[model samples]
Target: MTSPPLSDLTVVKRAGRIAAVQASVALALVLLVVGGVVFAVYLRAQNRQIGAELRTLAMTADDANDPPPDMELALRENNGHISTSDGGEPGVPLLTGATGFSDIHANGREYRTLVVDRPEGRVVAMTDLAPYHAGRNRLLMALGFAELAGILASIAVVVLLSRRSVRPLANALALQRRFVADASHELRAPLTVLHTRAQMLAHRVGTADVRTLQKDADALVADTRALGDIVDDLLASATMAARKQARDRVDLSAVAMSVRDSMASYAHSIGVTVNLECESADGTAGFDVIGSAAALRRALTALVDNALGHVHHGGTVELRVRRDGAKVTATVADDGVGIDPDAMATLFTRFSHGAEHTTREGREPYGIGLALVREIADAHGGDIAVASKPGEGATFTLTLPAAPPA
Candidate 1:
């Protein structure tokens, strides 16, 4: 079955997250700036109105002996004593400015005062700002609530809109998953039948007198087995793709040793030696990582199997697990004919022609095993690296983050 396009889902989700964050930050900045500007304008206008009223009162006190009603006014003679105005002390300190306004605190109250200089003396007209200040404070409180509500509303809208916009992508991902599952299910039965038939024919041919037919049957069996392996790899890939994040404390040393031991018989049959190497910092046999045990075992098995299949009859494949600070690494090295630099470039890619370089007699490299290993590593939030020389050997290393200490 062909691989469906599920990668687009990841791209869409990542891009959506970035865009939503940027939009939210931009919206917050815009609201804050606009609210600040409006508040500043209101404050300036309030100041202008109070100043104009105070100025009128000051001018009225300059023309007459009486002050405007409900307004506090003071007049000083040339010697700076209150002459005539609102009843006050005989010597009142009046501000010197003629047409300017200043704020003052008097009698536990805030006031805006305008000073005017007349031909006789100076006149001071004052108005309390406490009421205006209270109103402004209330307005600011309302605006603060409004700004907060707006930010929350914008976040809600962004979340809802982002989800709505990605509906099509989500649908596409669902369809792809279904397609892959169905296709793998459908192919499973036919591949099983073919393998059974090939095995039956090979068995029947073993008793035939025609030697040529026997040889042809052996080849047929090998090819059919290889095809079955390919199908199995495809099904495994599909299964892995469908799995969700399931992180647990996985013992890398155990997984590596288990994979090495499991592949021992196969390596012996192919005239290759498989070895396991593991060590802890304090000389223990445990190296912990955050991942699924089954998945890690499968990935290590694939690497070991790949290495064994490529090495020659007397070649050695070593599986090593080691812990380095906050990371654990599992490495598979084979002293077989090494990989070409050209082929090594695309070695881990799925179905790449470069991965099918060499194989043992009964084992064929389908170019899918390494790809599956890489996928498994990535799913566990790990990474794989390869190093090889044309004639020396190749090494595959899988690195995973160490689990936090218990």
Candidate 2:
């Protein structure tokens, strides 16, 4: 059996955590290897220095009564007599006849001993290993603390770096999911319009005149072409990078009119009326804005579609466009069951619903269309706003930069 598919958020989070752990482990291993090398070198040097000191004392000492600091000397005569230095401790292990370097442990302490044979007698030189052992212990303790600190630091650094490195991937995944959802929502309205037109064409085929048949066929073709355009636009958006696409002058009034026309059949089918009103600061017919025409149309279509979904039968949905200063504003207003004040905060959030309404034809709002509209408006260097009350109507206004005059 196949495993259930993971969400984009889950995949991104898991990937980031895995990357952090792998990086932390890698850094920890490096620290361990370095520390091990340093520790090994320290032990080797300490042992070598101790051996040299023992050899020196054994070969050059003349009297057992005087020995180097922290060292003990023992002399054995041919007659088997034994003696120790004045300051020597009692527990130094002395090899009677052995004549080489060796280690001796006695009285819970360690000693490095060197026995040398001389002309008159035998000499034994010894040094306590306690201080050297203490030094080694100190070094080990320091290394242990350093390793702990290094591991902790590595974990922190790796987590921070991994989050920074994976942030772009996370954003891309989020955008991909949003794109798919937006595409699906964008296609729904046109598909519905096409389906409605097809049904009408089929019903009129039996008794309709040739001219009427031609009109229905034309309408179906136009809807299909519009659907194709939406698909192409979505595909282009997916493949292209942001802020790099070519933009041209788009008339907000024209977009509003087109949205009203496209949604007319669907709205009529649901017993709702769609209207368009345009005004300009200079009393011009068109309000020009610089952006992608297809995107602007999609944005307006989403607004109208959302309005149609919420409004009851016989309700009026209006598309109003006007120019103010350097901005062109288009508003979609509907006399439907207005949105609740509490739901306004999340109205543009994907997959969020608004106030309860008795939808026409069982077409409940899926809550993706308005979110896409907001994104489109943002992409065009514009913003959207809404005003609504519980019992009154709702108005969504999209404002975009006006195109400079030719």
The numbered model that scores best in TM-score is 2
Pairs of residues at least 3 apart in sequence or in different chains that clash in candidate 2: none
Candidate 1, after superposition: displacement of residue 48 in Å? 36
TM, every model = 0.51, 0.58
Q: For model 1, what is the error of residue 396's alpha carbon versus the real structure, in angstroms, after optimal superposition?
A: 0.6
lDDT of 1 by residue, 1-406 (tens): 9976647778788777777777877888888898899899999999888888887776665533555554577777687565544533221455444456677766676767777787777877777677789979988998899889988888778877887888778787877776576555545655665677676666767575777666667666666666666777777776887778577888899888888888898788778899888866667535898878988988898888878766877889989899887788999999977787898778887655344334565443556778889899899888999998866778999998888887
Clashes of each: 0, 0
What tens digits encode model 2's per-residue C-alpha lDDT throughout 53-139?
Answer: 988888788768868777898887778777888645442345354678787776676788888888777888888888998998999
RMSD, each candidate, Å?
Answer: 12.5, 7.5
| Superposition-based RMSD of candidate 2 using all C-alpha atoms, in angstroms | 7.5
